[model samples]
Target chain A: MTASMQSSVGNPADEKLGMNLTLRIWRQKDPSVKGKMVTYKVTDISPDMSFLEMLDVLNEQLIMQGDDPVAFDHDCREGICGMCGLMINGQAHGPQQTTTCQLHMRSFKDGDSIDIEPWRASPFPVIKDLAVDRRAFDRIIQAGGYISVPTGTAPEAHATPVPKADADAAFDAATCIGCGACVAACPNASSMLFTAAKVTHLGLLPQGQPERDDRVVNMVAQQDREGFGGCTNIGECSAACPKGISMETISRLNHDLLGALRAGARPKS
Target chain B: MKKAVMAVSGIVMVLYLIAHMIGNLKVYTGRDSFNHYSEWIRTIGAPALPEQTALTIIRVVLLAAVVAHFWAAVSLWRQARRARPERYVTKKAVAQSYASRTMRWGGVIVLLFIVYHILDLTMGVVNPEGHDASPYDRLVASFSNPFITAFYVISLLLLGMHLRHGIWSATQTLGQSNRRRERTVNAFAIVFSTILIAGFLIVPFSVLFGLVD
Candidate 1:
C-alpha cells in the first residue's frame, strides 16, 4: 500500500515520509458574509494523497483545534462526478487538467503554498466557500439541451446508423461534466463552451436533429439570460475544461445559431 | 446572431481598410495620379448613374455596417459585464493575448481616430493648413504637421492591434477555425494586419518626411 493509505489509518511508521505544506483557503460563513483567505499549515501530508484528501486532513486539524473547517464540495472522489471544483493557485480545477479529487499532492513541492478559492462569476454566487450555485447551467440545459421523443421504447442501438465521425464528435461533446471550471477560468465568465458542448452533443446525433434549430436558439438565449458573458473566443474555456472540450464546439454552436436565424426561427420565450 | 453581425461587419471593415490602403499608396505616384484616383472614386457610376452616386452607395453601406458593428460590440460588452457581477479577488489570465485583452480600449481609440480622420481629411475642418486645396495637397499639408502625423501613427498602431485580434476572432466566430488550422489562422492575422498598417502608415510618413511631396 501507499504511504497515504498507511497515514490515513494513523500509522506512525509512515509519518517520516510525509511532507509539510501551507494552504490559503477562502472562508465565508454564507453568501452574505464577507469572505477572506485563511491560511493553515499542514504537516506530515502524504505526497500520494489527493488534493481533497489533503483538505480533509486540514479539516480534521481545524476540528481538533476547535475551529471551523473550510467548506468545499465533493461527491465522487473520482474525476467524473463534476461535484468537486476549486480555483487552486488561480486555476480552475487546480494546476492539472483533472478535477480537484484527481489532483494529487505530488504536483506540488514540500515548501509550496497553494491558494484555493471558489468560482467567482456573478451567476455563481458562493454559498459558503469553494462551492457556488451552478444551477444557471441547469437552467440553460432545461431551455432546450435535450432531444425529445416518445417514452417507453428501447430502440435497437444500431437502427440510428450514426456515422463514426458524428458519434465520436458527439461523445467528445458529451464528455462535459457540467463543472463550472470553464466559467471560473474565463475572463468574461462566459459559459459558451459549456453551453456549446451541450448544444453540439445533441446537435450532432440523428436523434438531436428535430430539436436542433430550437435547441441552439433557446439554449443560447437562456445562457445570455443567465448573465453569463458573451464568448470573445479567447479560448480559456477549453484550456480550463477538465475534459478538454474543444472550442470548435462553440464554433459549431455559432454555426447552428446562424442557420437558425437564416431560417427565421425564433427561440421560444 | 449578435456575434454573427459583429463578424460580418468586422470583415467588411477589414476589406475596406485593405482597399483604402491600396488606394492611398497612389499618393506616391505624384499629384496628378493621386488626385485623378480621388476624383475617379466620385465618378465611378457617372452617365449610367449621377456623379458621386457609387461613392454615396458605398458610404451608406459602410455606415450601416459601422452602426451594426458598434451596437453589437456595446451589447456584448454589457452582457459580459453582467455575466460576472463580482470580480475575482485574485485572478489569472490564461490563454488570452495582449491584443485580445486590449480589444475594447483599442476599439475605442480606433473609433476616436476615425472621427478625427474624417474631420481632418474628408471635411477639411480640422486640417492645420489650407482646407480649400486639392485632395493631394490637403494630404500633404496635414501630415506635415508633427502632431497630426503622431496622431495618425498612434491610431494606426492601435488599429493594427485591433485587427490582429479581430481577424482571428472573426474567423473563430464564423466557425472557420479548427485545432490544426488555428496556428495558421493566427499567423495569417498577424501578417495581414502588419502589412495593412504598414501600407497605410507609409503615406503619412512619406508626406511628413517630404518623400512624396
Candidate 2:
C-alpha cells in the first residue's frame, strides 16, 4: 500500500493532518437582496479537498447548525460542464483557466482567506448567490448559430472528407462549453468570444456552408441586439478562455461580419 | 465612387504625408532650405494638380477628404454604437495594449488639434496672443512656447496612435485582406505613423531649441 494509505491504516493520528481556513462568501437571499460577504471559519479541512468540496463541507456544517446553507452552482466536477463559476479574488473562475469545480484547495496555501463572489455584470443578473442566469448566451446561440441540418439523419462521420485543417479549426471552436467566463473576464462584458466561437464553428464546416452567410448575419445582429459590446480586439476573452480559444476566431468573426455587411449592401444582382 | 472615393482620398492623404515629410526634411538643410522649400511649394505648387488651379483644387480635395474621412468614421462609429449599447469596465487594463485602448480618445483629441492647426496656420485665424511675425516667423515663435511645443508633442503622439489604427483599418476597408499584404500594410502603417509623428514634431522643436533660428 502507498504511504498515505498505509499511514491511515496504521495510525489514526495520521488522518488528522488537515488545515484550518476561512471563507468570506457572498450572502444574498436572492437577486433582490443586497448581498454582503459573510465570513465563515472552518477547521479540519482535507488538504486533498477540491475547492467546491470544501464549500460542501462548510455547507454541511451550516445545515447542522440550522443556518441557511450557502447556495452555489456546480456540476460534472470535471470542468467540462462549466456550471460552476465564481470570482475568487476578482478573477473569473478563480485563478484557473476552466471553472470553479476543477480548482483544488491545494492551489491555495493553508490559512488563506479566500473571498468568493458571483460574476458581476449588468446583463448577468444573479439568480441566487454565485449563480447568474447565463441564458443570454442561449439566446445568442438560438439566434442562428446552428446549421439547418435536418433531423433524424445521422450522416457518416467520414463521408464528407473534411480537409484536416478546417476540421481541426472547427473542433477547436466546438470546445467552447458556453461558460460565461469570457463575458465575465471582459472589461465591457462583451460576448464577442462566445458568439465568435459559435459563428466560427459553423463557418468552418462544409456541412455549415449552406447557411454560412445567413448564420454570420443573424448571429452578429443578435449578438449586438443582446447588448454585448463591440470587440476592440483587446484579446482578453481568449486569454481568459479555459480552452484557450484563439482571438483569431474574433478576427475571422469580424471578417465574416464585414462580409455579411457587404452582402447586405450588394442586393440580388 | 464610394470605395474609389475612400481609396483615392486615403492615398492622397498618404502621398501628402510623404511629400510633407520630404518638405519637412528641409529642416535638415537648415532654415534657408526649409523656408525656401515651403516657398517653392507655394510658388511652383509641387504635387498639386495642373498649374495655378492645382493649389486651389488640392485644398478643396484635401478638405473634401477631411470631411469624408470624418463622415465615414462617424457613420461607422454610430453603427457600432447602436450595435452594442453597453461599454466595458475593468479594474485592470485587461489584454489591450495602450494604443488599442486609447484609439477613440486619441482620434478625438487629434481632431480638435487639427482644428487648432488649421486656424493657426491655414486660415490665419485665432492666432496665439503675443506671437506676431511673418507666417514663418509665427511658426518659429509658436514653437518657442514650451506650452505650444508640449501640446504639439502630446497631440502628435495621439496622431501617431490614430494613424496606426486608421491606416491599417483603411487598408482592410479597401479589401486588401491577403495575409502577406495585410502584414505588410500593418508594418507599413506603424512605420508610416511613426515617421509622420516624428517629422511633424521635429519642426516645432527645432524652432523652439534655436536650431531653426
Candidate 3:
C-alpha cells in the first residue's frame, strides 16, 4: 500500500495524536429551511481519523447533549458510493479526490479550522444539512443511457462480445459515480463533464449503437433543458473530477452528436 | 437548449462579423464605391422601408444575439460561482489557455466597450467633446485618438479571445461532429475570427497612421 492508503486507524503514529479543531459547518433543518454556517469547537480528534470519522465524533458529542446532530450523507465510506461531498475551505471534497469520507485529517495541520458545507447549486437541492439531491444528473442520464435491450430475457454475458478497446473505454467512462463534483468545480457550473461522460460511455460501444443517435440528441437536449451551462472548454471540471474524467470526452460527445444529426438527415432505407 | 441557443446565436454573430468586415472593405474601393455600397444596403430593403432598415434589423438582431450570448454567459458564471462557493488561495488559474481563463472579466470589458462604441459612433453621443459627429467623421476622429485606438485594440483582442472559443463551440452547437468536419469547422472558425480581428484592427491603424486619411 502507498503512503496515502496507509494512514488509517491502525497506523501507530496517528494513534498518538490529538488536536483541537474548529469546524464551520452548514446547518439546515431540511431543504426548506434557510441555511447558515454554524461553527463548533472539536477537540482530541485523532489525526488518522477520516474527515467523516471526525464528523462522526462531532455528531456523537452533539447527540450526547440531546442536540440534533448535524445531518450529512455518507455510505461505502471507501469512496465508491459517491454519497459524501463537501466544500472544505474552498476546494471540493475538502481538497482531494474520492470523497469527504475518504479524506484524512493528516491532510490538514494541527489547530486548523475547517469549513464544511453542502454542494451549492440550484439544481442540487439540499435534503438536510450536507446532502443535496443530485437528481439533475440522473435526469440528464435518463434522457438516453443503457442499450435498448428489452425487458425480460437476459443475453449471455459473452454472447455480445465487445471489442477490447471499446470495453476498456466504456469501463473507464463508467467510473463516473454521479458525484456532481465536476459541476461543482466548473467555472460555468456546466454539466458538460457528467453529460459528456454519459454520452461517451455509451456512444463508443457497439451494444449502445442502436440508440446512439437518439442518445446523444436526447441527453444533450435534456442537459440544456435542466439549466446547465454550455461548456467553454476551459477544462476545470476535469481537474476537480475524482474519477479523472476527461474534457476530451466533450470533444468526442460533440463529434458524435453531429454524426447523429447528419445520419438522421439522410434518406432512410 | 442552452447549448443550442448559444451555438445558434454564436453562429449568427460569427456570420455577421464576416459580412460586416466584407462590407467595410468598401473603404478600399474609394468613396463612390463605399457610399454606393451603403446606398445598396439601403436599397435592398427600400420603399415602405425606412432608410437603413435592413441595417437596423441586422443591428437589432445582432444586439439580440449579443444579449443572448452574454445572458447565457452570466447565467453560467453565477452557477459556477455557487457550485464552488469555496475560494482557493491557490487561485493561479494555470493550465487553461489565457483566452479561456480570462473569459469572465474580459467579456464584461468587451460588453462595456460595445456600449461605448455605440454611443461614440452610432448614436453620436459621448463623442469626447460631446458634439455629435457624422458616422464618417466619427469613424475618422474616434480612430484618430491614441487613447481611443488603444482601447479599441485591447477590446479587439478580447473579441478575438471570445471568438477563439465561441467559433469552435458554435460549430459543436450546430452539430458538426465528424473529425474531418470538426477540424474543418474549427479551422474555419479560427481563420474567420482572425480575419475579423485583423479587418477591424486595420481600419483604426490605417486611419491613425495616415494610411487611409
Give the best candidate by DockQ. 1
TM-score of chain A of each: 0.93, 0.89, 0.87
Write the residue-wise lDDT of candidate 1 on B1-213 in tens digits.
788899999999988888999999999889999999989999997788899998898789899988999998899898878877776666777788888888888888899999999888887888766568788988999998889999999999989988898998898888777666888989999999999999999999998888987
Model 2: per-residue Cα lDDT over B77-104, one tens digit each: 5644553333322233446656666766
Using DockQ as the measure, name the better of candidate 2 and candidate 3. Answer: 3
The candidate with the higher TM-score, 1 or 3, is: 1
Worst 10 residues of 3 chain A by lDDT: A260-269
Q: What lDDT does the true structure give each of the candidates? A: 0.88, 0.71, 0.75
Per-chain TM-score, chain A, candidate 3: 0.87
User: Which scores better on DockQ, 1 or 2?
Assistant: 1
The CA lDDT at A161 in model 1 is: 95
lDDT (10s digit) by residue, model 1, range A73-140: 99998899888999998899888888999999988888788999999888898998777888999999
Candidate 1: give the TM-score of chain A: 0.93
The DockQ scores of all candidates, in the order shown, are 0.58, 0.20, 0.20
Q: Which has the higher lDDT value, candidate number 1 or candidate number 3?
A: 1
- lDDT ranking, best first: 1, 3, 2
TM-scores for the candidates: 0.92, 0.77, 0.73
The candidate that achieves the highest lDDT relative to the unseen native structure? 1
